[model samples]
Target chain A: MTEPKTAIAIQGLEKVYPGGFRALQPIDLEIYQGEIFALLGPNGAGKTTLINAVCGIVNLSAGQITVNGFDHCTQYRQARSCIGLVPQELTTDAFETVWNTVSFSRGLFGKSANPALIESILKRLSLWDKKDNQIRMLSGGMKRRVMIAKALSHEPQVLFLDEPTAGVDVELRKSMWDQVHELRETGVTIILTTHYIEEAEEMADRVGVIHKGKLLLVEEKNKLMKQLGKKEMVFELQHPLETVPPELCGKNISLAAGGSQLVFTYDTLQEDNGVTDVLDCLKAHHILYRDISTRQSSLEEIFVDLVRAS
Target chain B: MNFQGIKAIYRFEMSRTFRTLGQSIASPVLSTVLYFVVFGSAIGSRINDINGVSYGAFIVPGLIMMTVLSQSVANASFGIYFPRFAGTIYELLSAPLSFVEVLMGYVGAAATKSFVIGIIILFTAGFFVPLEVKHPIWMVAFLALTCVTFSLLGFIIGIWADGFEKLQLIPLLVITPLAFLGGSFYSIDMLPELWRKISLANPVVYLISGFRWSFYEHSDVHLSVSIAMIALFLTVGFAIIAWIFKTGYRLKN
Candidate 1:
């Protein structure tokens, strides 16, 4: 398949803090335009550090980052102007009205004040009603929406949300996911970092797994699930068996419930998948089965296995 | 470059000042008025005159300088420091502005505040005693210079400070004390011998002396030296701020 246009290009980025903690280790990745790329990692897995480095908040120890073809270091204003970041912390100015705070963010990027655009952004985030309210007066979810409004105020090409739904309730998280999908429809390349595996499964087009400052893998979400996701087929046997039938003994097969059932694990990516072969072997051994069932492992299971192995 | 970015910070700081008018404007203006009422009248009744100017008039320029210096430091420092303390500086750090533009915005707002306050004190002093400015141009020059210079100093202090106490520490312990001893209330000529030389070493002395000279045509130091000292201090302040941004000291890793 032809590669999509690159929105953000990170080349050999490395960050070793002053105290010698390597926050990121030579992470080289490219995020395509209009795709929801989720950097999924556990706590202390350098997700925040990586986002901070790209946003130019945390200075990178080494490497180059180009945002929309502009070198981040050499042309910072042009590069940073194309990106917006909603930090993990809710760090709004408490006394500022929602309208002013969002306007301030737009002004920070050298953009002329466009009240109508800011109003539209707030309205889209369902925060237009609270435009005159002080940030301190809003609830946690409103403040988060205000953050998103501020990030979108400047009309950036790429939006980086560091754990956007971290502390949100289930209902709010779903709404936020819907908002993210809407943003993607508007042609904003959204890169979010989250430890919520289900969030990645729900929202991301591509997923990257980072652990111990190292980026282990980056792949299309559906492709990753298909490649690593294993399927288990269980056979309900009518009679107990001492062990797996000799015909299927050495295969990716096993017995369960004290031989009352036979379990065979297979990869979906494989053309044969051993489904037909397992049934033939069971019949050849005279192991009668009342019924059969198969189940596919989820992305969560694949993610856990990848992290554990690394 | 990035004029809008500079204006954003400048306008934000200015708005904060207006929002906290009680602490930022009213408090300083009230204290300066109290100083004029107490020192101008009480001392004017006794000393009568200093270097051919009435005691009340002689202290006018001094009072304005003192208030401007301290307010400049306090305002600029709090303007930047509070954002850092509140964790909102990430927005600034991640903005498209260069460090110079940011400085222009913050220091510009701070200096404007102190300048306005200094003018208020100067006008209030006129009501207490008859005043005449020997050179109004130089008077305005000194007032503006003092405001800008001290605001720059405060911006540096804000970046260097990590905690709230440290922010208040410099203005309270260092700036306030320096203004008190820097000949704001008395001329260095009044000090006998040893103390006179000691007072000369205070950098704030040059600021007050130059400003006083503009009003009464009398100063302890030569005009050239005072102008040179102010210039030197301004250059140093810019150099330090540039270094802070270059090294990303206490701002970024």
Candidate 2:
């Protein structure tokens, strides 16, 4: 297929900190327009550092970044104006009212004041009632929502959320996720960094994994699952046995639950899974089963496995 | 030249100052009044007129300089330092504002605050001492220039200092002592010959002398020297600030 329109393109990006710490190796990735891309990585995997570099909080040691069509350094103003960043830290001006802070954020991007647009954003984020309240007076979750509102105030074409759901309650997380979906519907490209594999699995059209300051892989979410996913068949025996039968000992199977259950693991990509042969072996051995079930490996397991290999 | 961005930052900083009226405006005014009561009454009686101006009037320029210098530095330093301390600086860093625009917003607000305070102290001094302005225009110029220069100094200190104690370091240990010795409370002319020579080294002397000349046309140094010194300091402050932004010193990691 022809290449999709790119929203953000990072080429040969690398960051070497002052103390000789290599925070990121060379990374090249392109996020397509109007897509929800999840950057999944564990703690200290340079996920935040990468985002900070893109946002201009950290100076890049090497490489180039382009947001939409503007160069991040040479065309800094236009590049910055096109992007919004909801930082990992909940840093707000304590004495400022929610309304003023959010409005000020919009002006920071050289945008004219649009009160009606701001009002709608507040109402959408459930912050309309607290608009007059000082930011410090709001709860942690509300403060997070204020950060989101501030990020959106500028009407950026691309948004970066660095661990948006971190330290958030499950209910608030759900609401934030719904809000993100609504924003995406407006054709805003979103790239979020999260350690919650379930979050990536639930929301991302594509997933990128980073570990040890290196991007290990980037692929479409469904294709990744289908390529790496494994299946397991579990058999509940009609009677318990002291040990596995001699004939089935060499197969990729294990007897567990005091030999009352048998589990057979197989790669989903392989055609000859040996299910029929295994069943014939079971019949010849006079083994009977009460029930059978199959399960596919989850994204979390795939994430853990990826990290471990690196 | 993002005027809107500069305005947003300026308004935000000014509003913060207004929010803490007791600490920012009231306390400084109250302290200046107490200084007038103690020094004007107690010391004014013992000392005769210097350079044909009354002791109380002569010290008016000095006292205003003392208050304006320290306060300008303190206000500007705190204004920028608190944002860094709170981690809210990241928002500004990520915004589309150029470094110069950001500097203008912060330094402009700080200079304005100090100028207003200096004017209030001048009015308050009038209640106790008879004051005259020989060159009213020059008086206003000196007051404004000094405020802007010291405010810039404070901005540099704010970025250089990484902690609370360090933030107060130069203002307390360096600038305040320099102001005291630079003839805020006593004229360098009153000092012994050797001390007079030593006092000339203090940068605050030029500021106070130039400012005092505006009020009485009497100064320890020539009018041009004071004016040149002020310009030189202002240039240095701007140069340092420009370098900081260019190198991303203490701003970007």
Candidate 3:
């Protein structure tokens, strides 16, 4: 299969609303085929705006987007035909049956009716039994699943899930992630925007962090953690200290648990890590510890720092 | 170009019409029949004829025009409006649907709905008044034209409006009143000279008059002018819709 490697490319993309609101700054991003790319951003960080721009739902102020090597503006139909967007809003035809709604979405992409394909999708989403049920009658989770089914009905190579699990229950979220992984295995490139740091940690091959209308960084999951991660060493002090000693005050050290523990934070990427020097300094300062434990920073910590710093 | 896409949207809208039969079909039909009963029997008995034609028969074309105009606009405006309201418009926008295809599906289904109601109202009016068409072909032509034209107007209204009240604004404050004054109940010819002069300015006048001409070959305006007005409305409506699509107004951003 000589399929293109770049599933979607955004170059110098910018969006400025008429009211002088700059929703997105000029940015460049590329999502490859068959990769789970997670976009992490807090509210109003342009995560949805970026996704919408590529989906052609939001008009771009500048730059160009190409999906499957088709220009999103000049070659709109082809570019759009390659994308399936599961919008943040849980919107569906309230009166329509699940089967007809999904089938209709497929047809909108110019695909001929294929009941077998539609049936398989419904079955896969665990919605086969409720296929005849009106959308209004389905539970919230089922409705979201139907949205996913409708998006996939067209069989687009790239799927954009904007906050797919926003209001879903934990179990539903887990099942949804499982379904996403299954879809990824079948060669669908999934790009999801989420506030759940654990989701990115668990699901993304590559993670992009955006803040205040700018994409701060895009990196492999492990690489991001390694590059920016830190480890904290906590020493259970033999005696509670009312204050830090003068000599140990300059380093990445702090007293925690109301002075019951002395915490030393160090960069994981640094070679020395300074754990030995810290212990020696602590020993020399008559700072005795009962025990010591080290823990690496989670993705959530890194994400918070990245956004907070910017 | 995307025939399947158009069909899917069209079928979905048509199915919604069926599902809400009372609101979509029955309400308009029943309302128009009520109009025929009150105006045709009550008003017609008081005023025997308007220019030689029986009042009951004379008001038929106008009544049909009234029902068709409002129904077409109401059907189409709400057809597109509901999708926007429910936010499912994102599905259509993000899909591979061209603006034309989306418009075709929505406008086509809406026109068909109103056309069906128009025919039903025509038949319902027939029971109230003994009707005859001097030019049956022109009658059908005007019926289809008015359905499509007003439906386009409704489509425009759907895009232009943001609130539920705005959707009903033009249909009620503008369209209904225009229809009443546009010679739906009495001809502009029957109005005082000053009022008649002002009445010609109402766009609905041409629509109802042209439609009436096809009934008894009698109209306030010349048949050619009536045809011209229909063509003008169709052209302008098409242009505005094309502009909306091109600019992606209300659909994209």
lDDT: which is higher, 1 or 3?
3
Best of the two (1, 3) by TM-score: 3
**Model 2: per-residue lDDT, tens digit, A1-310?**
9778999999999999889999999999999999999998889999999999889988899999999989999899999998898999999999899999999999888888999989999999999999999998999999999999999999999999988998999999988888999999999999999877888888899999999899999999999988988788999999988888889987788998988999888887878888888888999999999999999988888889999999
Stretches of candidate 2 exceeding 4 Å from the true structure: A240-246, A255-260
Model 2: residue A16 alpha-carbon error in angstroms: 1.1
Candidates in order, interface RMSD in Å: 0.8, 0.8, 1.0
Ranking by lDDT: 3, 2, 1
Per-model TM-score on C-alpha atoms: 0.94, 0.97, 0.97
Clash pairs (backbone) in predicted model 1: none
DockQ of 1: 0.78
Can you give the lDDT of residue B249 in candidate 2?
A: 86
DockQ for every model comes to 0.78, 0.83, 0.84
Clashes of 1: 0
Error of 1 at B127 (Å): 2.0
DockQ rank, highest first?
3, 2, 1
When 2 and 3 are scored with lDDT, the better candidate is: 3
Candidate 2 CAPRI grade? high
Which digits, one per residue and each the tens of the lDDT, describe model 3 over residues B1-253? 8899999989988998989899998998898888888988877878868777899899999988998899899989998999899999888888777777888898899889988988888888888888988998999999999999999999999999999999999999999999999999888988899999999999999999999999988999999999999999999999999999888899877
* Poorly placed runs, candidate 3 (over 4 Å): A1-4
